[model samples]
Target chain A: MVPVEYYVGLSAILFTIGTLGVLTRRNAIIIFMSIELMLNSANLLFVAFARTFEALSGQIFVFFVMTVAAAEVAVGLALIVAVFRTKDTINIDEVSSLRG
Target chain B: MAPVNLNDLLTILPAVFIVVWACVLLLVDAFAGALGKRLTPWLTALGLVVALVLDVSAAGVQASAFNGMLEVDGFSHAINVLVLGAGLLSFFVSYDYLNRQGIAKGEYYILMLFSISGMMLMGAAADLIVVFLAVELLSIPLYILAAFAQPEPKSEEAGLKYFLLGAFAGGFLLYGVALVYGATASTRLSEIVAAVAAGLENPIFLLLGAALILIGLGFKVAAVPFHMWTPDVYEGAPSSVTAFMAVGAKVGGFAALLRVFIVAFPSLGVDLAPVLTGVVAATLIVGNVAAIAQRNIKRLLAYSSISHAGFILMAIVPYADDAVHRDTAAAALFYLLAFALTSFGAWAVVMTLERAEGKGLELSDYAGLFRKYPALALAMLVFMLSFAGVPPTLGFAGKFFLFRAVLEGGYVGLAVLGVLTSLVSAYYYLRVVVIMFMEEGKPQAAGSPLLNLTTGLTALGTVGLFFFSQPLLDWATNALLRLF
Candidate 1:
């Protein structure tokens, strides 16, 4: 069987990349995609740990995470569209009128 | 899994009622058009009032329902009352503003009901899965509400920014849950604590998980370092939505933080205490210091709200010591009540002063408000004093209890810093009072009777509750999470 550590290592790398993308990306769409990546990484961790511990609860948690992520995609994309309609730009920097 | 029972259903009755009512309200709005639009707010109020009544009826009852998924206790009951009350008041303050802005719709109240139900569930959630679901339920509606003024770019940007940041934090929270589950082989909070007491498969994972969870919640409450999106979101969202979000969201976030950390992870308290203390300190310094620079009233209040989060954290940071947990919990709850009353009153005043198209939001616009409306100004003065923790106000009582609790827990330095920061916070809070009474500028106000009623009632509660809140204080004291 593939080792659980390998799964953890993969998820950790993906999570780090996702975090970096969210911090650095300027495009609203890209930032949102990064957030999805981060959520999937956690899902990967949950599945890995569930297998390692032989528990159904962790696996069940992943289903809820997937459901939430789908709902988020619906809202997040709608928001991006709303921003684009008004500002005509999806760049986070250009959307900056309310800043101090 | 145990089969669902009648008792389990009763345990989560308030939240269930809200969800069911929201669905029914959606159908009512969809078929009814303008009639539905007008009926929505009243119906929403009716539904919330029903839930509030049901919640209070369950006050003396306690149970672990849904086979340990939901908890019915004083803690949950208090949170239900707070969030429901905030939701209902938001409607009152919002009624005129929403119509005036020409954005009055059935959806607004529906979204709020969904969010309130989520918050109520947050207080009662005894399992991690439920907590995660509750957070999403509360937040998604708010993201949409923040942008409800769109095609106004500011509102849309606020919605998008809040969504991005909130989704990112949810990732962290999910990872934290996964890690904690990995360490303990359980997702139930009560079971997690039991496992920790017995010993964990890995302690490192637990610590890391808790830290990540803290980061997620910190963002929700707008604590410093995690608060980058707060000012812009608060400034951009419609004023009525901002007011509701400010009170309701904080109540839910803090409720979960207390239950998850203090109830589920008490074993890690000694280790997490220093970290929480540092967060409290930074939140106080940064939240207050940044507010001094804000010209926009909404952004300033956002920062003030953050600093209040810090003072409440002072009580929470000391929960590691068992001897002090009850006192700290009570302090935190009382402070939340103070913040809710004072915050709603101040926002009602802000809403009153706001001109069409969000023009009258600058701090300078508040000048000369006292000349036209003496009663309104005095009520605003009471709100400002309460927020500044001045004597003969609820804010003072809240702070006194919080600091005393922290001091007893041996965090003398944090308590002292809390005091110093209160002095610093007073400068900015009082700035509004000065602008209203002393300065000169013609500030137009909507002067809606509903708005005035909100301001008067909350203002009265702020000062009167301070002096005559012994029974309420006793209730807060008894509102502990002892379900295990």
Candidate 2:
């Protein structure tokens, strides 16, 4: 019963929030979470659009996106752990050993 | 669902071979222990060779498979050869470097193979979902491989930075796909083309989607403004990994770019061409001018590769010009091949000369390299010349084809800018050559025969292919013929 425009608008707002979070966050974990937020927002839009059009492909795509996000989390957290072991911090600014 | 056929399975046989072999190798490495680590590189190389042969043999079978999710054709075949060849060269170069660095493991080869399969799929994918999957499949392994040297803090940092940016780019790409699907009610490239031809339901959504997709792919290819991750990632990661990423990622990104823009969005050309032209110009200016300031060799080459991305972009700028589309696409393919060989060769030399703790990375470390290793110096010189688009090398021929395509498309300004920027590139590229031969300092290099063989072969290809480029050009032309 909900209007499709409202769903799209909510998705846009969520995506923007996620983008800002990724841009401003200094902690690597938060950035990873923000990326998840962004992906989830896209999933939300995908579902809404799929329902509106009654197309299964868009819904199917969300499943793929979620699976990929989970896999990314696995790899991303491992990388963070690796960084923590060596650098003793997850703050991106403090992890600056390589620069031009 | 339609019943699957042998033809459908055969169409994606190369990628299937790689994925299955990579998984088997992963298990073998876990169980077999040290022997697995020793044999992994050779096994990985063998898998790539077999896949390459499969790709070549299936060259004549051009059809969409998996209900139009993927298309097997000349374009995919040509790009597969480049990706697989890059994988082969990376394997050869990594064998000794990994051992020397004390990080030799089975996962390295497995991850490389996994990523190569992803890249090959990118070349074949006909649906946006497949494209997104392929990109992630290629990139996730690279993120892990970037941090493969677990104890190295810089490598870890590189991995994290690459992952964060890569995830952000992936988000943009997914959003773009959603928008496009909403507008066209389909994700298949052929279907999208038909919809656009019939007139888009919402042109604004389609345009925004196309631009977002470009942003996502631009990040992958390291185009200017979207290329922040490249220098740090390339510099901090191991040289062998950086070499593979430089060629593999660029080729994969461009493969999708060519297909998505040319095949799916040709009707949107008038609106998209200017944006692409701007991207091409900025990539050239930023990628080259920035390289001049870098003192580190890896960082310098990273910037050079970014500029090379720009040169390759020139070939795609004319994607909408039907008169020149095939030629331009072929030119782009040829340029990718040339750049891959040259980059692999240069990085192999860098990997050989690099010392523990990353001590021999500064430009001054390369001073007097000629005295210690004349053959290495000569190989580096050839690579540098090739990068600068000098004569008697594939880079020259590749550039000639690209500029001709640009000129044919009536973008004389871009062609001219390409020429001028290449002239500027000559200064930095030649500086490496000048340092290797003219400057005096003792730089010891490892005598890894495999590494030496990689460097020698790529250098030989760089020069030999210049004269024999007609066959490659013909192959590239044939590849695009089916696409159009």
Candidate 3:
């Protein structure tokens, strides 16, 4: 079996990738996907904790978090579509008329 | 586990009721629009009104519900009313603005209902996960609404900026929760308090967690340093959305801020209070000084909001004892209510002046406005004067109470700075008034859509508030007395 450290390491790596996406990606969709990745990493950690602690609540929480994440993805994607339909481009840099 | 009691169910009844109402409105709008033109927004407003009535009727009934995931009290009830009232006003203001702009979709109102429901629940949430979830529920819809102004590049930018920064803040908050959970082994505020009381020798993890959480919420409330997004977002979003966000979102943010800092981590106040005081100082200084230079009216109001966050932050400073805490909390709560009314009215006036292509409304554009629209001018006067803390207005009353609370808490220096900033703020606030009454650089004159019943009521409520300050102050004090 893969050790707990392996799972932890994977989560850390995935989280870092998500963070990089958030910081560098100009595409709103990519940024959203990055958030999903970060959330999934958290879920992975939660599952590992549940397994290690022999607790059901942590796993249950993971399930609830997954449900919420799905809802967030749906809403976020819908917003992106609306934004794109308005501007005809998904370029984040192009939409800077609101600056102070 | 014990079975749910009537009191337990009653504790969360408003949230449940509003959620159901939102879902029903959404469904009805979907099918109704397919059949004919949907009347779901009006229906949603009616449903919120009913839920608000239920919330009011249940006032003063304090109870913990759903195994302590939620806690309902007069404080939460009051905030709920403010948020719902904001929703109601937003609906009325949007009715004209959206139709005129040709984007009056029923889903917007449903989204607002969902958001307000989340905000109501957030104020009452006692568990960390529940608080985070409540925040998300409130925020997600707002992100959409921020971008909902179709074909407007600025709207899209506002939504994206808010979403990105907001999501980043959320991550910090979540990580903080994780660390806190790891440290205390529980996410419930009661359990965390007990654990802290039980005395961990080194509270580094707890302190770090609180700091992260504070940063997260500081962003939400648009406190300075995390407030870079506020002006742009406010300026770009539709005026009604800006008004809704300006008042409703801040109310929700303050409610969460009060609960988290005052309740969950009460034990850490000794270490945290001074840090927060510094933040308050910075927020006030930055918000006010930046506002003085703004040419765009919306951006100016955004900076004004940041300064108000400073005043509210002053209220969050942990007291030397419970009495001082109660006093300051009451001041903050009352100030928030007063701020909501005046700010919304100010934006309503701005919305009223919006042109057909929706391109008018700038600081210079307000020149000699009083000559054209006297009633609108008078209403605008009330909003401006109150914002400047002129006497016999709710804004002045709010400032008085806040300064009194600061003095009582021995923050004499902070109170002095607050007064000084108030004086500085007068320059910008009075600039609006002067532009209206004195300046001759004429804005291409146009007729204001006569104030509808709801906007009229909102303006009246703000103006009439000086008469009601005493009773409102009493209720706020009483509610806060229960908190500590």
* Docking quality band of candidate 2, CAPRI definitions: high
- Root-mean-square deviation of each candidate, in angstroms? 1.1, 1.1, 2.7
lDDT of 1 by residue, B358-472 (tens): 7989999989989988888999999999999998999999988888888888889998999999999999889889999999998888888899999999999998988866677
For every prediction, compared with the true complex, DockQ reads: 0.87, 0.84, 0.44
lDDT over C-alpha atoms for residue B424 of model 1 = 93
Better of 1 and 2 by lDDT: 2
DockQ of 1: 0.87
Q: Which candidate leads in lDDT?
A: 2
TM-score of every prediction relative to native: 0.99, 0.98, 0.93
Q: Model 3: residues >4 Å from true position, as ranges?
A: A1-21, A40-55, A84-91, B3-8, B33-38, B319-321, B441-455
Write the residue-wise lDDT of candidate 2 on B158-276 in tens digits. 99999999999999998888889878888999999888888866888888888889999899999988999999999989889999999999999999999988999887788888889
Please give, for residues B342-433, the per-residue lDDT of candidate 3 as tens digits. Answer: 88888888887777655666888888888876777778888888887887789989999999988987888899989999999999999898
State the displacement of the C-alpha of residue B185, model 3, in Å, after optimal TM-score superposition. Answer: 1.0
Native-to-model Cα distance after best TM-score fit, residue B132 in candidate 3, in Å? 0.5
- Relative to the real complex, the DockQ score for model 3 comes to 0.44
Candidate 2 off by > 4 Å: B3-7
- Using DockQ as the yardstick, the better of models 1 and 2 is 1
Order the numbered candidates by DockQ, best leading.
1, 2, 3
